[model samples]
Target: MKALSYLILIPTDPIYVPTEEQAETGADALEALMPAAEEVTYDMFDDVRFIDGGQAFEAITCPLCGKDAQAWWHNAMDKAAEAEFEELECTATCCGGQTSLNALIYQPAAAFTRFTLVATNAGVGGLNETDLTAIGVPLGCKLRVVTQSI
Candidate 1:
């Protein structure tokens, strides 16, 4: 099967949701840059939700111990899903330290967000710092991109 790619942008702050206007502005900026994208979309969720990279996903690391936490990550994800991801707190198996699942470093990048702007099949590798700043201007917040392929 051919892999499909999505470039997803989210607020740096996990729980932040951009206003409709802000979201529109960000989407416009993204579309302008990714003119060849198959589609662009804005999604707002009532509750925080996970945006994973599917087959592109890589290992997750413990924030406290900096060890591979892939073993613990799935169980934590299942537990968090039980509440629709309203709660992300978990104890790291590596160090037994308290942390939010959102704090774990995903290799290919993932996040918990209430809002997102996505460009499908964008083809570009990733946004540069200048491009990120350009898009962030209208959104009025720092942003991060997660590249998902499946």
Candidate 2:
């Protein structure tokens, strides 16, 4: 099934992974940090995932129609693996508008301590050094951030 999520991932798990309780604690910290955001969830690194989600569309919007890109995603799926785009520039099939994959808007697809924290309507921005440090204090380590769309 298709899901719309923005994933925040770790570059590597620590030598000793946190317990679910630890994960929950970390998630709660994040919740406090991003109170406007949706609940945070976790996913342990069971499968290898991209550190940087290259070519992924943060959102699919046609410049012309100003509508969801899914509206014109007629043949895009078939070309996915073949195109292997780190970024794309094309014309929409629906309104024939220009299309370009750009910055992530929302929908988290993360593996947060094996939990989830999605803010579909809230805004997410880069975590500064201070913020990262705060988040790490509870988890006892720094978390590398990667943005991925699903």
Candidate 3:
């Protein structure tokens, strides 16, 4: 079987979601940048969802203490999943600091978002920062890109 790769753009703030029109504009902007992309789409969810990087995912770290937070993150993910990710708050074990799962630093860039703009077969390894900022303009929010292969 062949692997499929996706380039997903999500808001830097997990709780922030663009309006449908804004999302469409963002999608259009991304399409303009990746004209050879096989597909481009945007999705909106009623609740925040974890947008992981699939095989690209690596270790996670606590934003507070800069320690390996894989174990803590997993447990917190389970708890948050119970609520369908409606709540992302958690307490960090390393520093005993309170934080949100969304704030955890994910290797290879995973994120929590209620909306996403995705491009399949993006046709390029990555977008430069300038291109990303251009795409984010119409969406009215800064974006974080997550590349996933599955």
Candidate 4:
């Protein structure tokens, strides 16, 4: 049977910005825009998991003796610094090998804000689009899956 896992990141602080009119008028218009100013709310999502496709396999043969060699699989998650993010690693039980996957979440300290998600896949085979999408973002958040392997 195949297994799947999900991880979610939530912002602990509230997101606020100046009104459209105030932004156009400049800082001097703060007073006028204060009354009509609005707050932006970012909702958090629950983590969910589903059946992932079966593992990918590769045949290995020993060149010296011309014999078959043992093989294994691995998977994991790693988070970047800031917001006290933590890394989580999981290995395949049957394979006895491990892969450390890292999920880095970084936000700028400047006026403009940005978010980035990166993953590292270190194994013989790769993960499918559906599986990466399922694991990367929250259930409802706008998350685009961008994946590459080495």
Candidate 5:
């Protein structure tokens, strides 16, 4: 089977949001930190497969309030909930300050092949966690680690 991989880049800090506005102007500082993937094309004869290696943040701080916000690594299949994935708590000395930060790498199972196929299809739009789960990816949910560095 031909294995496919996607490198999704997300901010270690929740303060940043990826959007079209950032994609334009060609000068968004956040663009430097966004994730990138190599180009690949699958032909009709190719077998579809997926390899998990995406990263997610543990904690992000508010630039103004400096309050810490926890991070999560959710499986596409897992339902969204208040306490579904991992959570990082504030540890900074400052009152209400947040310090913990984490990044997670998710690997999809064999079932993820369906999602990959959709993502690769020319008629299909794109694939998000929800789309991945809708197809049949396993639920290996939750943040697995916590650390200062991303």
Candidate 6:
């Protein structure tokens, strides 16, 4: 059966690119927030490709200008994928600014570890402020909350 999952992207840094120390702290804080929350690394999403419609990306591309920044992005992701562990990360090479890879889409993008709080019984609408605050504040990072029913 499919279930609605609240995918909360809690990066160690506010910009979404976490340092080694911050990632570790965020992980601990997350577990403290929800003892039942299962921790996962980017590898869990082994073959996820970012495709908005029918297109597939080979690497990071500009979502707004639709430019190919794969070469630059590759270097960034390799360095940032799993900061506390393996470190897969990226900034907007195309945008020429501090845009986190977590905020952009990648084709064949490396999976960065994050949290998923499943509201199996309540579904998406049931998520509340208490739920948001509990997860957000303790982590000391911004929360990218999105729902996935699967």
RMSD of each: 1.9, 10.4, 1.6, 17.4, 15.3, 8.4
What C-alpha lDDT, on a 0 to 100 scale, does residue 101 get in candidate 1?
A: 90
lDDT (0-100) at residue 81 of candidate 4?
24
Best by TM-score: 3
TM-score of 6: 0.37
TM-score preference between candidates 1 and 6, better one: 1
Please report, in order, the local distance difference test score of every candidate based on alpha carbons.
0.88, 0.49, 0.89, 0.25, 0.27, 0.45
Worst 10 residues of 6 by lDDT: 42-51
Which lDDT value does model 1 have at 76? 92
Q: Any runs in candidate 5 off by more than 4 Å, and if so which?
A: 24-87, 90-150
Best of the candidates, lDDT = 3
lDDT of candidate 2 over 44-115, digit per residue (tens): 554322233344445555556666766445455335324553224456676766654322111232212322
- Sorting all predicted structures by TM-score, with the top scorer first, yields 3, 1, 2, 6, 5, 4
- Shift of residue 4 alpha carbon in model 5, Å: 0.9
In model 2, the worst 10-residue window by lDDT is 103-112
TM-score of 5: 0.25
Cα RMSD of predicted structure 5: 15.3
Off by over 4 Å in 2: 1-16, 54-121
Q: How does residue 83 of candidate 6 score in lDDT?
A: 53
User: Which candidate order results from sorting by lDDT in descending order?
Assistant: 3, 1, 2, 6, 5, 4
Cα lDDT tens digits, model 5, 1-150, are: 644433222223322222333223111221222224233221121222222333443444443345542332232223222332233332333344443322212222111121121111122223454433332212222111111111
lDDT of 1 at 120: 95
The C-alpha TM-scores of every prediction are 0.88, 0.47, 0.91, 0.17, 0.25, 0.37
Cα miss at 67, model 6 (Å)? Answer: 8.2
- 122-144: candidate 6 lDDT, tens digit per residue: 32333356665555565555454
Pairs with steric clashes in candidate 6: 42-111, 80-87, 80-88, 80-89, 81-87, 81-88, 81-89, 82-87, 82-88, 83-87
Candidate 1 regions exceeding 4 Å error are 1-3
Can you give the lDDT of residue 80 in candidate 6?
59
- Clash list (residue pairs), candidate 4: 78-101, 78-102, 78-103
RMSD of 4: 17.4
